[model samples]
Target chain A: MSGISLSTTSYRNVSIVLFTLLVVTLVLAELHLGPLAWVAALVIACAKTVLVAVYFMHLRFATPLTRVFALAGVVWYVILLGLTLGDVLTRAH
Target chain B: MTHLAIAPQFDDAAQQHESAALGMWAFLATEVLFFGGLLTVYTVYRMAHPAAFAEASSHLYTWIGAVNTVVLLLSSWTMALAVHAGAHGERARIIRMLAATMALGLAFLLLKAVEYYLDFHDHLVPGRAFRPDWSTNAPAAQMFFILYFILTGMHAAHMLVGVLVVACFVAVIRTTPSPARHANALELVGLYWHFVDIVWIFLFPLLYLVA
Candidate 1:
C-alpha cells in the first residue's frame, strides 16, 4: 500500500515537471530565436517523449527485452532520417 | 493466484502479461515507422524550403496547438493514473481515471475541429482553394499546409480510435467481474495512449513552432 501511494506521488511529480517543460518550450517558441529555437524545441520535445515513455508508459519498470523492443522503433527511425537527410544535405543542387 | 483466467496457451499469468506487453511494444514499434515516414517527408521538405515552411507554420493557430498539447499531456497523466489504479486493484479509481482520460481526448478532438474550421476559413487547406499569399514561395507554402493537414488529420484519427477503445474497455470493466484481472489489458491500452501522446508532443513543436 505504501509503495502504491509513493508511486502515485511520483506520477504527480512527473506530471508537474512535464507541464513546466511544456511552458518553457512555449515561451521559447514565442521568442523566435531562429534556428536555435528549432534545436531547443526538438530537444525539449525529445525530453518530454522520454519522460512519458519512461514514467507514464512504465518503460522504466519494463523488462530489458521490452525496453530494447521499444527502442528498436526509434533506432530504425534515426537510421531512416539520417540516411535520407544525408542524401538531401550532400546533394549538389 | 487463480483469479486470472489465463489462456490455455500461456503457462501462467506472468507469462501472459509479459507476452502481451512484448506484443504491444512490437506493434508500437511498427507504428513508430508508420508515423516516422511522414515525419521524414516533412523534415526533408522543411530542410529544403526552410523559409517557406517557417512562414507557412506561422499561419497555424499556435494557441490552439499549445492548448491541445496540454490537453494530450493531461490525458496521458490520467491514463497513467488509470493504469496505476488498475495495478492496485482499485477498480473504481481505474474507471474514473479512464473516463477522465477519454474526456480529455474528446476535448482535444473538439479543439482540433475548431482549429480545422478556422483553417478552412483562413483558406489554409491545401488545394486550389489554398491561399498562398502567406509566403513568398507559394508552392512550398502550400506543401507545408498539405503536410500540416496530413499529420494532424492522422493524429486526430488515432485519438478517435483511442477514445473508442477506452470506452469499450470502460464498458467491459463495468459489466464484468474482477476488473483487477484486467490490469494487463489496461496497461496495454495505456501504452497505446501514451504513444499517441508522444507523437503529438513532437508534432506540436514541429508544426507550430516552425518560425
Candidate 2:
C-alpha cells in the first residue's frame, strides 16, 4: 500500500471531526464576540485547513520533502500578510 | 499483484508516483500564492474599512454561504475516498466516488448561481448598478462588494474547472484497462480539488461572517 493511502474508516473519522469543527466555527460566528469572534473564526479556519491538508490531501503520509514544500506556500503567505498588515496597521493617522 | 508499467524516466511505480506527487505539490504551492495575494488585498482593505466591510458582509446570505461550505467539504471528502479506492484498484468504487464528488461540485455551483442571482437582484455588483442599502459609507461598502465578487467569482471559476476535469477523468477511467495505474493521477487531482476547498474554507469566514 502507498504511504498516502488511508483506510475508509479513517477517512470517515476525519470527515466527522471536520464537520464538528465546522459547526463550532459557525456557532462562534453567531456569538458575535467582537474582535474575538474574528479571531476565533480565523483560528478555527486554520485548524480546518490543517485537517484537510493533512488527511484529505494526504500531507501527513507525504514524504518530509513534500511536507516542507507544502509548508513553504503557507509560510510565505503568512509573511506576505504579516508584513503588509504590520505596515498598514502601524501607519500614523 | 498487477504489475505497473514503469515509464522510461522512472525506475519503478513508487518513483513515478512520488515525482508526480511532488510536481503536483509544487503546482499547489504556486496556487497557494495565487489565492494568497487576493486574500492579502482583502485583508488590507478590510482593515482600512472595517465598518464598511462589516456592513457589507451583513447583507450577504450567510445561510447560502454556510450550506455551500458544507457542500464543498462533503465533495472533498468524496474526492478523498475516490483516491483511496483508486489505490486499492477498485475501479467501480473509484468511479462511484468521483461521480459523487462531481455531483457535489455541481450542487455547489448551483447554489452559488442562486447566490449570485440574489446578489444581482440586490444591486451588489459594484458598478453603476451598485446601490448598497447601508446608511453610511456607501463607497467603502462598494469596495467590500468588489472584493466579494472577485474572490467568490474566482473561487467559482475554480469549481467550474474542477467539475470539468473530474467529469473528463471519470469518462477516461471508465474506459481505461487498468484504473489502478492512474492512482497517482487521481491523487494529484484530489490535491487540486482539496486545495480549492481549503480556499473556500477561509473565504467563507472572511466574506460572509465578518459582521
Candidate 3:
C-alpha cells in the first residue's frame, strides 16, 4: 500500500529533467529541424504528459477504473476525429 | 477472496476508487467531443485553402507559440506535482505546486497577449481591416487568421479560467483543513490541464508546421 507514495525530491527531480529536455528540444527544433520540428516537439510532449499522468496524477497507482476513464477520453477523441473527418471528406467540394 | 468478501460493502475503498475513475472517464469523453468540433472546423479550412493557409501561418510568431507551449507544458508539470503531493498527503507541497502552476499559466496568457498585440500591429488580424504586407489569397488568408485568433483566443480564455481555478484551489489548501475528497478535485483539474496541453500539441503542428 505504501509503495504508491512518491517523494517530493523525486518529483522535483523529474520536473527539472522534463523541463530541461523541453528547452533543449525547443532549441534543437528551432536551430535545425525547421517546420518538421513538430515531430520532436510532440515526442517530448507525449513524454511529459505521461510523466505527469503517471507520477503527478497518481494514475500509476490508481484503480483500473480510473485508467479506464482516462483511456475513454482518448478513445472518444479518436472517434470524434474519425466521424467528423468522415463527413468532411465525403462532402461535395 | 470470495465475491462476498468484496460485495455489499458501501465503504469498500476499492469500489469507491473504481466509481471515481469511471466518473472521470465519462467527463473526459464529453471533453473530447468539445474539442473535436473545433478540430473539425480547423481541418475544413486547412483543406479548403492549403496554400493560403500555409502563407497565413508563416506570419505567426512561431517562437512565441513555441514559448507558450513550453510554458503550458511547465504548468502541467507543476499540476502533476501538485496531484502527487495530494496523494502523498503533503498539503504544503501541494499548495506550492498549485501556486507554481498558476504562475506559469499566467505567463502563457501574457505571452499570448503579446502575440495578439503583434498580430494587431502587423495588420494580421482579420475582420475587414487586414493588411498583409506580402499578400496572396487575402480573403482566405484573412479567414485563416480570424480562425486562428478565435481558437487561440478561446484557449487563452480557458487558460485564464484555469489559472483562477488553481488559485482558488491553492487557497483552499492553505486555509481549510485538507480533506481526502479534494483528491478527486485535484485530479479533475489535472485532467483539464492535460486536455488543454493536448489541444495545443495538435494546434502547434496544424497551424505552424503544416507546410
Most TM-score-accurate candidate: 2
The TM-scores of chain A alone, one per candidate, are 0.91, 0.92, 0.75
Best by lDDT: 1
If the candidates were sorted by their TM-score against the true structure, best first, what order would they fall in?
2, 1, 3
- Model 3 is docked with a DockQ of 0.34
- Candidate achieving higher TM-score, 1 or 2: 2
Question: Chain B TM-score of all predictions, in order?
Answer: 0.97, 0.97, 0.89
In angstroms, the error of model 2 at A86 is 2.2
lDDT of 1 by residue, B53-152 (tens): 9898888999999999999999999999998888777778988999999999999999999999999999999888887675699999988988999999
Clashing pairs in 2: none
Q: What TM-score between 0 and 1 does chain B of candidate 2 receive?
A: 0.97
Stretch of 10 with least lDDT, candidate 1 chain B: B1-10
* lDDT sort, best first: 1, 2, 3
Those runs of model 3 whose alpha carbons end farther than 4 Å from true positions after fitting are A1-3, A6-55, A87-93, B1-10, B179-181
Q: Can you write out model 3's per-residue Cα lDDT over B33-100, one digit (the tens) per residue?
A: 67667767877787778778878888888889888877877787788778767655578888888999
Q: What is the TM-score of each candidate against the true structure?
A: 0.96, 0.97, 0.80
